[model samples]
Target: MYPLNLPPAQILQLSSQLLCSGLALLLVGLAAAYGLEKQLNVPTLVLAHSLTLIGPSVLKIGYVLRLVAQQRLKDETCAHAIA
Candidate 1:
């Protein structure tokens, strides 16, 4: 797990990196689909795209869950320190 203590700038950079990668993947998928339209069936193409997007969607959910868990741990630690 990545440390949430990462600097804001670093976090922003990581996020932008992920965003660009996802965009690139989408572009590549689109290009391939366009190029292979005659060879690939439309339903199969759509299904593959749908399944491929699930991976990123799950990744996003996992990231959010980690952030939430980190926040909760931080809150607990601070509370313990203040008591």
Candidate 2:
């Protein structure tokens, strides 16, 4: 668990790290798509485009999952507070 006293600078740094990691994953997925198209004898152009299309959806799903987890945590906190 993260310390509750985390400073704004530390938060910003963590945000930057997450953004960079996400970008790296996106690039790796693209590269994998390219390789799959070439090695699997599929249509490279179409698969690359599909990768672009699917990448955002994958990221959004991750965002949704994070939101759900956060929401659940918040609810638990509130429940504890009330009790």
Candidate 3:
């Protein structure tokens, strides 16, 4: 499902990175949003909200990429073994 035509290992690597980044973003966003709620700062709140929205999307994409990569790797191994 990913757009990139990369090897399964490469996709897996990229997905791992994305998962880390997404988790970090999600935690930071949640903390920022909670802590900044009392400040009533528009820009900061907007940034926090943006991060909150983007984090889950990135996580989902990363998860899907991981699944696809793993599936491809499994298929490749099975094909090679059967040959």
Among all candidates shown, the one with the greatest lDDT: 3
The worst-scoring run of ten residues by lDDT in candidate 2 lies at: 2-11
| lDDT digits (tens) for residues 8-80 of candidate 3 | 9999999999999999899889888887777858898889978898999899989999999999989889999
Per-residue lDDT of 13 in model 1:
57
Candidate order (TM-score): 3, 2, 1
lDDT of 2 by residue, 1-83 (tens): 43334443444455455545556557766776765555654465565656666666656655544554555567668999999
| CA-lDDT, candidates in order | 0.61, 0.58, 0.90
* lDDT comparison, 1 vs 2, better candidate: 1
Which candidate number has the best TM-score?
Answer: 3
- Candidate 2 local accuracy as lDDT? 0.58
Better of 1 and 3 by lDDT: 3
Question: How far is 10's C-alpha from truth in model 1 (Å)?
Answer: 27
Give candidate 2 misplaced runs (Cα > 4 Å): 1-25, 28-42
